[model samples]
Target: MVSTGITPSGIFHIGHIREILTGDMLTRAALDAGMEVEMIFIIDTADPLRKVYDFLAPEFENYIGHPIGAIPAPDGAGKPSEGGNYGEHFLSPFVEA
Candidate 1:
Protein backbone atom coordinates (compact mmCIF):
# COMPACT_ATOMS: atom_id res chain seq x y z
CA MET A 1 0.00 0.00 0.00
CA VAL A 2 1.28 3.42 -0.84
CA SER A 3 0.94 5.84 2.02
CA THR A 4 0.80 9.60 2.00
CA GLY A 5 0.24 12.30 4.58
CA ILE A 6 -1.14 15.82 4.52
CA THR A 7 0.87 17.50 7.17
CA PRO A 8 -1.31 19.86 9.18
CA SER A 9 1.29 22.44 9.89
CA GLY A 10 0.31 26.10 10.25
CA ILE A 11 -1.91 27.37 7.46
CA PHE A 12 -2.17 24.09 5.58
CA HIS A 13 -5.12 25.47 3.59
CA ILE A 14 -5.02 24.61 -0.14
CA GLY A 15 -2.15 22.17 0.22
CA HIS A 16 -4.18 20.04 2.57
CA ILE A 17 -7.04 19.77 0.11
CA ARG A 18 -4.66 18.92 -2.72
CA GLU A 19 -2.93 16.21 -0.77
CA ILE A 20 -5.53 14.24 1.13
CA LEU A 21 -8.63 14.44 -1.06
CA THR A 22 -7.40 15.58 -4.44
CA GLY A 23 -4.46 13.18 -4.45
CA ASP A 24 -6.59 10.34 -3.25
CA MET A 25 -9.15 11.13 -5.88
CA LEU A 26 -6.48 10.79 -8.52
CA THR A 27 -5.30 7.52 -7.05
CA ARG A 28 -8.81 6.13 -7.07
CA ALA A 29 -9.29 7.18 -10.68
CA ALA A 30 -6.01 5.60 -11.64
CA LEU A 31 -7.06 2.37 -10.00
CA ASP A 32 -10.30 2.38 -11.95
CA ALA A 33 -8.24 2.95 -15.07
CA GLY A 34 -6.51 -0.40 -14.50
CA MET A 35 -3.46 0.90 -12.74
CA GLU A 36 -2.15 -0.82 -9.64
CA VAL A 37 -3.09 1.49 -6.85
CA GLU A 38 -3.10 1.55 -3.10
CA MET A 39 -3.84 4.60 -1.09
CA ILE A 40 -3.23 5.25 2.57
CA PHE A 41 -4.26 8.42 4.33
CA ILE A 42 -1.94 9.40 7.06
CA ILE A 43 -2.67 12.18 9.52
CA ASP A 44 0.83 13.07 10.67
CA THR A 45 0.06 14.38 14.12
CA ALA A 46 3.50 13.61 15.48
CA ASP A 47 5.34 16.65 14.31
CA PRO A 48 6.23 19.22 16.93
CA LEU A 49 5.68 21.96 14.38
CA ARG A 50 2.02 21.04 14.11
CA LYS A 51 1.63 22.48 17.54
CA VAL A 52 1.99 25.83 15.89
CA TYR A 53 -1.06 25.40 13.69
CA ASP A 54 -3.16 26.17 16.70
CA PHE A 55 -1.46 29.50 16.96
CA LEU A 56 -2.37 30.32 13.41
CA ALA A 57 -6.01 29.55 14.11
CA PRO A 58 -6.06 30.65 17.67
CA GLU A 59 -9.81 30.62 17.83
CA PHE A 60 -9.66 26.88 17.42
CA GLU A 61 -6.44 26.39 19.31
CA ASN A 62 -8.22 24.87 22.25
CA TYR A 63 -9.06 21.93 20.01
CA ILE A 64 -5.54 20.85 19.68
CA GLY A 65 -4.84 17.02 19.85
CA HIS A 66 -7.93 14.94 19.07
CA PRO A 67 -8.11 14.51 15.31
CA ILE A 68 -7.61 18.24 14.97
CA GLY A 69 -8.00 18.54 11.22
CA ALA A 70 -11.61 17.47 11.52
CA ILE A 71 -12.44 19.59 14.47
CA PRO A 72 -15.81 21.14 13.86
CA ALA A 73 -15.89 24.90 13.66
CA PRO A 74 -16.92 26.27 17.05
CA ASP A 75 -20.24 27.50 15.72
CA GLY A 76 -21.05 24.52 13.49
CA ALA A 77 -20.57 26.81 10.50
CA GLY A 78 -19.28 25.23 7.28
CA LYS A 79 -15.89 26.94 7.08
CA PRO A 80 -12.73 27.29 9.16
CA SER A 81 -11.38 30.34 10.85
CA GLU A 82 -8.59 31.95 12.78
CA GLY A 83 -11.60 33.38 14.36
CA GLY A 84 -15.23 30.22 10.52
CA ASN A 85 -15.87 26.38 8.64
CA TYR A 86 -14.54 25.53 5.15
CA GLY A 87 -17.87 26.21 3.49
CA GLU A 88 -18.57 29.54 5.12
CA HIS A 89 -15.22 30.74 3.95
CA PHE A 90 -15.64 29.40 0.45
CA LEU A 91 -19.37 29.52 0.08
CA SER A 92 -18.92 32.23 -2.51
CA PRO A 93 -16.76 30.15 -4.83
CA PHE A 94 -18.77 27.04 -4.11
CA VAL A 95 -21.93 28.77 -5.16
CA GLU A 96 -20.36 30.01 -8.35
CA ALA A 97 -18.86 26.66 -9.16
Candidate 2:
Protein backbone atom coordinates (compact mmCIF):
# COMPACT_ATOMS: atom_id res chain seq x y z
CA MET A 1 0.00 0.00 0.00
CA VAL A 2 1.05 3.63 -0.47
CA SER A 3 1.11 6.06 2.44
CA THR A 4 1.70 9.77 1.99
CA GLY A 5 2.17 12.78 4.29
CA ILE A 6 2.56 16.49 3.45
CA THR A 7 5.12 17.13 6.18
CA PRO A 8 3.45 20.33 7.36
CA SER A 9 5.76 20.47 10.36
CA GLY A 10 8.45 22.06 8.21
CA ILE A 11 11.60 20.44 6.84
CA PHE A 12 13.28 20.08 10.23
CA HIS A 13 11.44 18.20 12.96
CA ILE A 14 11.42 15.15 15.16
CA GLY A 15 8.16 14.60 13.42
CA HIS A 16 10.15 13.59 10.36
CA ILE A 17 12.17 11.10 12.35
CA ARG A 18 9.08 9.78 14.06
CA GLU A 19 7.26 9.27 10.78
CA ILE A 20 10.25 7.42 9.40
CA LEU A 21 10.70 5.34 12.52
CA THR A 22 7.03 4.51 12.57
CA GLY A 23 7.14 3.41 8.97
CA ASP A 24 10.21 1.31 9.58
CA MET A 25 8.81 -0.25 12.74
CA LEU A 26 5.54 -1.17 11.07
CA THR A 27 7.26 -2.48 7.98
CA ARG A 28 9.43 -4.72 10.08
CA ALA A 29 6.46 -5.96 12.06
CA ALA A 30 4.59 -6.57 8.82
CA LEU A 31 7.53 -8.61 7.61
CA ASP A 32 7.66 -10.71 10.79
CA ALA A 33 3.91 -11.23 10.39
CA GLY A 34 4.42 -12.32 6.75
CA MET A 35 3.12 -9.34 4.82
CA GLU A 36 4.54 -7.59 1.76
CA VAL A 37 4.94 -3.86 2.19
CA GLU A 38 5.96 -0.79 0.22
CA MET A 39 6.48 2.72 1.55
CA ILE A 40 6.63 6.09 -0.21
CA PHE A 41 7.38 9.58 1.12
CA ILE A 42 6.76 12.83 -0.73
CA ILE A 43 7.98 16.20 0.50
CA ASP A 44 4.86 18.00 -0.80
CA THR A 45 6.88 21.20 -0.99
CA ALA A 46 5.72 22.00 -4.47
CA ASP A 47 1.92 21.99 -4.23
CA PRO A 48 0.73 25.07 -6.08
CA LEU A 49 -2.48 25.75 -4.23
CA ARG A 50 -0.74 25.23 -0.93
CA LYS A 51 1.61 27.97 -2.06
CA VAL A 52 -1.45 30.27 -2.23
CA TYR A 53 0.20 31.19 -5.52
CA ASP A 54 3.20 32.50 -3.62
CA PHE A 55 6.62 30.97 -3.09
CA LEU A 56 8.59 30.71 0.12
CA ALA A 57 11.97 32.21 -0.53
CA PRO A 58 15.04 29.96 -0.38
CA GLU A 59 12.48 27.19 -0.42
CA PHE A 60 10.13 27.57 -3.38
CA GLU A 61 12.22 30.23 -5.04
CA ASN A 62 15.77 28.86 -4.85
CA TYR A 63 15.71 25.48 -3.10
CA ILE A 64 14.32 23.33 -5.82
CA GLY A 65 15.67 19.74 -6.06
CA HIS A 66 17.05 19.82 -2.48
CA PRO A 67 16.01 17.17 -0.02
CA ILE A 68 14.10 18.09 3.13
CA GLY A 69 17.21 17.20 5.07
CA ALA A 70 19.68 19.57 3.39
CA ILE A 71 17.72 22.75 2.98
CA PRO A 72 17.87 25.66 5.39
CA ALA A 73 15.14 23.72 7.18
CA PRO A 74 11.98 25.29 8.48
CA ASP A 75 13.66 26.06 11.80
CA GLY A 76 17.44 25.85 11.23
CA ALA A 77 17.69 23.13 13.86
CA GLY A 78 20.80 21.81 12.10
CA LYS A 79 21.92 20.91 8.62
CA PRO A 80 19.27 18.16 9.04
CA SER A 81 20.30 16.31 5.90
CA GLU A 82 23.29 14.46 4.59
CA GLY A 83 22.56 15.40 1.02
CA GLY A 84 24.90 17.59 -0.97
CA ASN A 85 22.37 19.06 -3.40
CA TYR A 86 18.66 19.52 -3.77
CA GLY A 87 18.25 16.63 -6.17
CA GLU A 88 19.82 14.23 -3.73
CA HIS A 89 17.42 15.22 -0.98
CA PHE A 90 14.45 14.91 -3.31
CA LEU A 91 15.36 11.50 -4.69
CA SER A 92 17.77 9.59 -2.44
CA PRO A 93 15.45 8.27 0.29
CA PHE A 94 13.31 6.34 -2.17
CA VAL A 95 16.38 5.25 -4.08
CA GLU A 96 17.70 3.48 -1.01
CA ALA A 97 14.34 2.04 -0.06
Best by lDDT: 1
Off by over 4 Å in 2: 6-11, 48-97
> Which ranges in model 1 have alpha carbons more than 4 Å from their true place?
50-97
Q: Write the per-residue lDDT of candidate 2 for residues 1-97, one digit (tens) a residue.
A: 5465544323345666677777777777887888888777666544322231122343444444443344543223223333353324434454475
- The TM-score values for the models, in the order shown, are 0.42, 0.43
- After the best TM-score superposition of candidate 1, give how far the Cα of residue 78 lies from its true spot, in angstroms: 22
**Steric clashes per prediction:** 10, 4
- lDDT per model, in order? 0.50, 0.47
Residue 97, model 2, lDDT: 54
What residue pairs clash in candidate 2, if any at all?
65-86, 65-87, 66-86, 67-89
Q: In model 2, where is the ten-residue run with the lowest total lDDT?
A: 47-56
